[model samples]
Target chain A: MSTLAFLGEFGEAIQFIFEGETTREGTQVGGSQFLELTVEHIKVSVVAMVVACALAIPLGLWLGHIRRGSFLAISLSNVGRAVPSLALIAFFVAYLGVGFTNVTLALVLLAIPPILTNAYVGVTQVHRETVDAARGMGMTEARIALRVELPLALPLIFGGIKTSAVNVIATATIAPLAGVTTLGDAIINVSGYGDVGRLAAAISVAALAVMTELTLGAAQRAVTPRGIRLESGRPSRRRTLSTRIGRTASP
Target chain B: MVASAVAALTAPLAQVQLRDRSGGDAGCVADDGLCPGWIADNFDRYVDPLVQHVYLVLASVAIGFAISFALALVAHRHRWMIAPIVQVTGILYTLPSIAVFFLLLPLTGRGSLTAIVALVAYSLLIIFRNITTGLDNVPEEARDAGRGMGLTDRQLLWRVELPLALPEIMAGLRIATTTTVGLATLAFFAGAGGLGGQIFADINFKSNVVVAGGLAVLLAAVLDAAILLAQRAITPWTRARAA
Candidate 1:
């Protein structure tokens, strides 16, 4: 096809995405509009991340504070890296039937390991001297964990959440496989929208992922304590997080 | 109660006996109705796709490693380039695999080429980050010593820097390889032909899903192990020091 023809098809698909349409045969499908699909994609990704954070953060914090179960945390992260997200979704869909809940659950499983590992690493990496000083000042274990460790660990915790957020958003593109309508609906159901639709959906998904990464990265930077911000001569937390994630995959 | 709930949910899906439209077998079973005998009978069908999947992974990782290594080297020398290069690759990495596959389809057409492009893009961030970090982590003392010994920059990099960086680089390669193996499964959506096509062909079939998915997992494990062994072989000092 000519480049102009391709662009015309792409423009038409974008129009279809904006202005909801009905088929010539009069079937009413309400899910493919760009705004609606974006909302669905965000909803699924946010819900999955929320669920992952709810489970992983507290557990990761407590485990890190206690400084035990390093083996478990490390192993879970490794296993998470090893398993394919598509396989997880397929397994859930096969057993649970297709729905938002099944996809969210699969994505939650996908998001957890990173958050957990990061939080664990974040807390554990807090200075030993700092913790000891807090203890010497008569702080309880819980108090020290909350007052001393949590604040210091916020950057890495946010890093983990940011990682999971980006991952969940990217993986959420497969939501259509589980009958949940997301941006992927355009690409997966090619008969419904054609090449234009696939390209547009791909564009939308990539934009969404980049947007999520930037937004969360800003949030991560914002949440870093002023003391740590002043310690910026150290390697930035973002690079550390990526390297940690990379290393954890192999170890 | 959970078991019954699962049974209730799955019962309806079982009735949908999706025919294999790809002309492999008309007698494919539904969800939960995996016929082991049928899987054994049709084992050969998976071999071609598995081989394709391996080729897809190897080609992508090889290309990705080369590009990432060069980029890492450039960024290492010119520190100003690292952030922009990382940002660009990070965005590429964050893009969904399915989206990338289809997006490239228009420009590259459907085949191994599109699949490799997408897979290579996905591998870059992991490999690039590791390579740069590995290079950066080379001890300043070691570099000074190499310079003191009158080693040329090229010789120093080849002999001292790259060797020391092997463990990290190998870690990156292992992650890239295993992750590529997983992502390659989705390349079937772009008509690239891999285990994903087989799994998608009979998504509800337990035998098909298990066999295809298992092979993908097995391939990941084997490749990971092979990389680990290669790392040990290349960095013999690491093991010797441990001993």
Candidate 2:
């Protein structure tokens, strides 16, 4: 295709997406019609993240507090990385039947490992002296975990959440296959929307993923304690090395 | 309430399938509800797509590693380049794979080229970050010792820096390999065949879904193990030191 013609076609697709027009076959499409699909995408992602956080956070905190089951926690993170989201969705759809619930359940599974691993790592990495001091101060075990470890661990925990949220949003684009209409509907139903629709869908989904990442990344930074943030922000040799390891190792 | 909403949404699609099935072969009545016989009958069909899938992953990861390695080298030298490069790759990483597949379709057409392009783009962040980190973590004393021997920059990098960075580089490769394998499942959308195509083709079939989905999981596990073995082989000195 000529560059000019390609640019024209791209522009037209973007217009079609934002302006919302009927197809040549008199079918209503695009524009506000995509709002419903976007909402569906968010609904599935939110539910999955919520379920993942609920299950992973408390368990991860408890395990990290006890400093046990490091092997299980690490292995589960590895296995989670190995399993493809498409395979999980297909597995669920085959057994559970196609529906929103099935897709959400699969996404929940996808979101869990990162959250769990980060939560565990965060609490376990807290300084022993801090916890000891809390103990010496007559703090109970529960109080120590809550008042001491949890606060210290918040940054890594939030890092895990950010990763999970981004991953869940990206993976949710495939929910249409399970009969849950999301932004993927435009891409999947090629006969209805054509290549133009597919392009528009891709643009929207990419925008959504990037936006979600930016938003959550900011949230993560905001939640980090000021003193720790100052320490981490300054690029000391040890800090840089640990940060790099943490970034690659966790998600 | 959510359960009811799901059921309501699935009803029409189920009815449509039922109507279509009325005219098709009745394969659901098989024993044990698994239809292993169906798999046995059609086992040959999966071979071509599986090969295509593996080919797609290998080509993309190889190309991705080369590009990322070069970029990491440049960033390592300049230092200022790392942040911008990481940000660019992060954006690429965030782009949805299916969208990327279709977006490239207009330019590259529907084939393995488009699929490989998207897969390569997806891998840059992981591989590049790892390589840069590996290079940065090289001991200052080792670099000074190499310098004391009057080695040129090229020799220093090849002898002192890269050897020390091998573990982190291998870690990145392992991650990139497994991730690309997972993402390549969606390449079928671009007409580049894989196990995902097989699963999608017969999503409702127990035997087909099991075989194809199981294969994808198996492929990931096998690739991960292979990388681990390669890392061990290449980093034999580390093992010797530990022993």
Top model number, DockQ? 2
Model 1 residue A82 distance off true place after TM-score fit, in angstroms: 1.7
TM-score per model over all chains = 0.90, 0.91
- Score residue A198 of candidate 2 by CA lDDT: 70
Candidate 1 A-chain TM? Answer: 0.87
Q: Which stretches of candidate 1 lie over 4 Å from their true place?
A: A1-10, A20-22, A27-32, A234-250, B1-31
Per-residue accuracy of model 2 over B1-243 as CA lDDT, tens digit each: 334324422331221111111212355623213565556666677788778878988899999999999998888789878779988998898888888887775577667899999999999998988888788778899999999999999999998899888888888888888888888888888777787877777676667678888777788788878878998898888899999
- Expressed as tens digits, the lDDT of each residue in B53-139 for candidate 1 is 899999999999999999988887888898898889988888888878866755676678989999999999989989888887788
- Model 2, position A63: C-alpha lDDT score: 96
What shift in Å separates residue A66 of candidate 2 from its native position after superposition? 1.1
Off by over 4 Å in 2: A237-251, B1-32
